[model samples]
Target chain A: MTLEILAFALAALLMLGGAAVVALTKDLMRLVVGLGAFLLGVAGMFLYYGHAFLATAQVFVYVGGVLVLVVFAVMVVHRANGGRPLVTSQHDIGAAAVAFGVSGMLVMSLRESVGGWLPESGTSGSSIAQELLGGHLVAFELLGVLLLVALVAVLLIVGPGERR
Target chain B: MTLLWGFLWGVAAVATIAGGAILGVWWERKVSARIQMRYGPQQIGPFGSLQMIADVPKLLFKEDIVPALADKAIFKYAPLFVFGPVAVSMVVIPFTAGWAPLNTSVGVLFFLAVPSIEVIAILLSAWASHNTLSTLGGLRATAQMISYEVPRSLAVLAIVLLAGSLRPLDVVAAWRWWWMPLTFVAFVIYFVASIAEMNRGPFDIPEAESELVAGYFADYSGMRWASFMMAEYGAMIAASLFGAALFFGGGWPFGGALGVITLIVKAILIMTAIMWVKWTFPRLRQDQLMSFCWKALTPLALVQLVVVGVVLVWL
Candidate 1:
């Protein structure tokens, strides 16, 4: 049990560390690498949660899909420019401060409201599916619609574009 | 006893890697050859069963070269990144009852998650090579993987819904009695998506040999190229294993040790089917590939998910 806890902690740390690297990296490609690491760590967390399906989905979708898109976009945009600039203006101090403040407040509020209580529901994959399809059917259906809209939007954005 | 189990697991994994690669390569050649109306590797050994063995030593002894301008560090490690996770994923894949080396509740997830690392390895290899075509191939691969991933996830989610557990064993057990129509659809989606993800024929735009030389590995030669091939074949086998485990009641029709053999047989059958598709179908244009996933497969998967949800509730 202690070992499991340690493993979870390690996985969480790895995820946060990767996210920090992604947030802090100056190099655009390096940022993508960090994001990949972050996703991998999240996959580890999913494994810890005994949700291999979710973990695998996270790997297949976020790490494989999102990271690849980001890399391709970077390449495309970079090619449009003569070459990628070595440095950009480090002018996001204000934005960072606002983000930090918002995060702090959100964390504080969560702590105050929930008081460190974690749900102990032994909701297996089947039970979760039942809940999603039965009681939360409307919300589930709404997510499906949202996904469809997103798919169409992606097509419109990416398809039939002029080759640069 | 723990050490003995670990040793046995290690041996099983090594055998799986070597044997899977050998069989997958042979099957791919034979299927492609048959599709092209030619005999493949018939001269070497019985039905060319030993051809892959002959190629192994040649590949191993070949020169490992690196371009002068390439990032030496990443170039050296990229193949490991590609190959390691693939081997590791087999740990969680149960061939027969109580036979998995690293059986966990999240077995299916572990199996699925490991292959994404291959994308990173490819991207890094492309960048490290510092070649124009290689870079473009890497970029294209990334785009392809990302675009197809949505439908793939939805399909897997549908399976998870049906199985009610994340373990691959559980998935097989769930399908033992009766195959759900929704699960069957999910299986088809999963199979197609897995093929695309592996960059097989039709979806082999990233590595289109005639057009892009060798795609992302255009600059790679000798052992580096071999590593990439090994990874691709490993992934093919892994995907086949996953498909067999989930959709076909893995290791069924055979009991105990024979079940493991049966599981391999199932995977090989799937691999051959994929190869047949590869050799028969012409490659899809890049835009067509994207549209197929986003426009066609994605919606079908979504509808399947809804239908499954409804069926689960009412039935």
Candidate 2:
């Protein structure tokens, strides 16, 4: 029980710290890295909750796919050069107030709903297959089509152009 | 006790990779040397097996350079990101009958997914290096790795489909004599895709020595640079081990202590074949490599999946 709690706390800290980095940092690259950290923390949360499949999927998909693209964009598009941070945030009173209010609401809501929510350990991999292919089959296949469309669009955009 | 055992096994896994990497490098040099008509590394050990012992220290103790423009933290730490996943992957390979060191039910996914993390590591190192050649190398490597992953996963999909479980133990548990000739195409696809994934010759456009000048690790020096080599060899070993279990009957013909030996011997044969192919084949051009992965390998992998499905259904 203690170990699980400690693990949960560490994962929460990672998510919070990563969020803080994304919120506070000026460097675009670091912001993407912060996002990666936040995603990994979410994976950690899934891991400690006995959903190893979900945790692995989280790492495999988000961290592996989206994080790479975002990082690549931050590097190439911004030309983030020689340690001078890109993607600077404008300091504003309104943004800070909104952030604080949002976090406060989250805390209050979580505190209220924290009881009787945790699942017992050890879900099988078949459950994931059933959930994705059985119950969510339409959504899953649609996602495939969506990604295929995006791929074709990108290829058409990049393909057989007059040399840039 | 389980946690302690996990810790110890993790340590053992890393140690195995490190030790295997030493022999791997030496053997690669010797093999390449023989292919090129020369004696290699004869001074260190009987067959120059210990040559890496002398070489690793030289690399490690040499001045570790961080280019002036490099991102200090990311540049310094990228090797760990690169090396760590490859090491963790070794845990799931079934070296004994009906068992692996870490026998998670998601063993197969663990094998595939965890190594994808190295893409981030490679990119980070590339971005951090801040050198144009290194950046170009990094971009090529990232593209190549990501592209090759499609076919690799698809190739492995056939094995998982046939085994009916993702666990390495289950995969090996269900391995039969006929599956060898049956899954040969999948094995070849897996083999070719894996070689590409590891950035080896014929597919090694990333670090094409004549073009990119050591590729993404161009600015890395000494131990830092060696870490990338270690990662490469570690990945090769892990991939070879897993391929042995998936395609070849790992730990077969006997199921006890001898099974482990059989598995290792099979893995070593695969490793040797990999080296032979690396030494024998010429490197591909960047466009050629990309085209081959998309147009050739991925489709071939898909076809193999269908064929395997048919075979499994009927037979």
Candidate 3:
């Protein structure tokens, strides 16, 4: 129990630290890093609460997918900027006040539904498999079909490539 | 106590990876040499088994070079990031009868999901190099891995489907001899995609040394550079062992003490096949690589998945 609490504290620290980096730093790359840390913290919380599937999905999608693309965008911009990425520190009181206000409002809004979002216990790997492969079987498997359709759609729309 | 145990197992897992990489490197040299009509490394410890002893010291003593323009922190730390995920994944391999080193409930899923994080580390290593070619290599690697991941996961999902559980122990426990033929196509797809995931040829466009000057780790030297190679060999080992356990039914036929030997032998056989395929195939063109993945492999993997699902339902 104490270990769990300590872990929870660590997750909280990561979330707070990440938010600070995102809010205070204007460097696009650092922002991406900060966002990654924040998303990881969120995933950690989900794992702590036994939302294993959600946590993994969060890491897979947000950290793996969204953040990577954002980093690429930033890198491309860096090349455009003649090497150095545009970065600054947002130390002004007005910006801080606005950021804090918006954050607090968001937290207040989420307070009621947070309990509903948190699962009673952490999900074990087996139960997630059963849930995904059983209850949501058709929907889940059809995702492959969805990907295949898109692949075919692109080929058809593009038509056979021009003879080399 | 639980944390202590986890730490100890983690150490054992890392040790297994290092040991496997050592053996794998020697085996790969010998096999590739035979394929080419060469003796390979004949000196030092009977057919070059101890070649790594010499290589390791040389690599370690070499001056570590960090590019002046490199992101020092990311550059220094990223190899661990690259190597660590594969090492952790090793912990979940269902070695022997109904046991894994870590034996987590979600072992199989954890094994598959965790390694995807390596892409981020690859990107960081490339970016930290501050070299255009390295960056380009990183991009190619990122795209290849992300693309191939689709079919790979679908292929492994077939095993989860068969076992009706995510636990590696359960997967092996539920395995049957007939599964070898039944999921054969899935096994092949899994094997091929695993090679791509490891960035071996014909999918090695990321580090196509002829073009990228060794790609993302180009700027790294000495021990840091060695880790990347170790990670690749380690990944090959882990994938082979996992695949052997899932599709080959691990060691059930041999049973008892020999079960462990059987599983290791199966994995080594798979690893040899991987090396054979690597040596034989020419690297694919970038466009060809992407096309082959999307048009050919992905569809075939899906068909395999459907076939497995149907047969499973019938049974």
Indicate which candidate wins on DockQ.
2
**All candidates' TM-scores?**
0.80, 0.92, 0.88
Clashing pairs in 2: none
Q: Given the true complex, what DockQ would model 1 score?
A: 0.35
lDDT of 2 by residue, B1-315 (tens): 566797899899889988999989888988889999999888877887777778888997999888887888889998888999899888989888877888888888888988988988998898888877777777888888888888988988888889898888999998888888877888998899899888888777878888889888988899889889989999889999899988987887789889988888999999999999999998888888888889998999999899989988897
DockQ of each: 0.35, 0.51, 0.33
Identify the leading candidate in terms of lDDT. 2
Lowest lDDT block of 10, candidate 3 chain B: B98-107
Best by TM-score: 2
Q: Write the per-residue lDDT of candidate 3 for residues B125-222, one digit (tens) a residue.
A: 88878898888888889888888888888898888889888778889889988888888888998999999999997789999999999888889999
Model 1, A1-164: lDDT tens per residue?
77678778878887898889877767666667678778888888977877655666688678766776676666666652243323364668986888899999999999888754433442355555666787789989999999999999988898878446
lDDT of 1 by residue, B1-315 (tens): 555686687677657777777777887788888888989889889999989888988888888888887767767778777777777777877778656678677676667666777887888777777677888888788778766767887888777777777776777666653554447888888889988988888799999998889888888777778778877787788888877867777778666899888888888888888888887899999999988999999999999899878877887
For all candidates in order, the CA lDDT equals: 0.77, 0.85, 0.83
How well does each candidate reproduce the native contacts, as fnat? 0.50, 0.42, 0.15
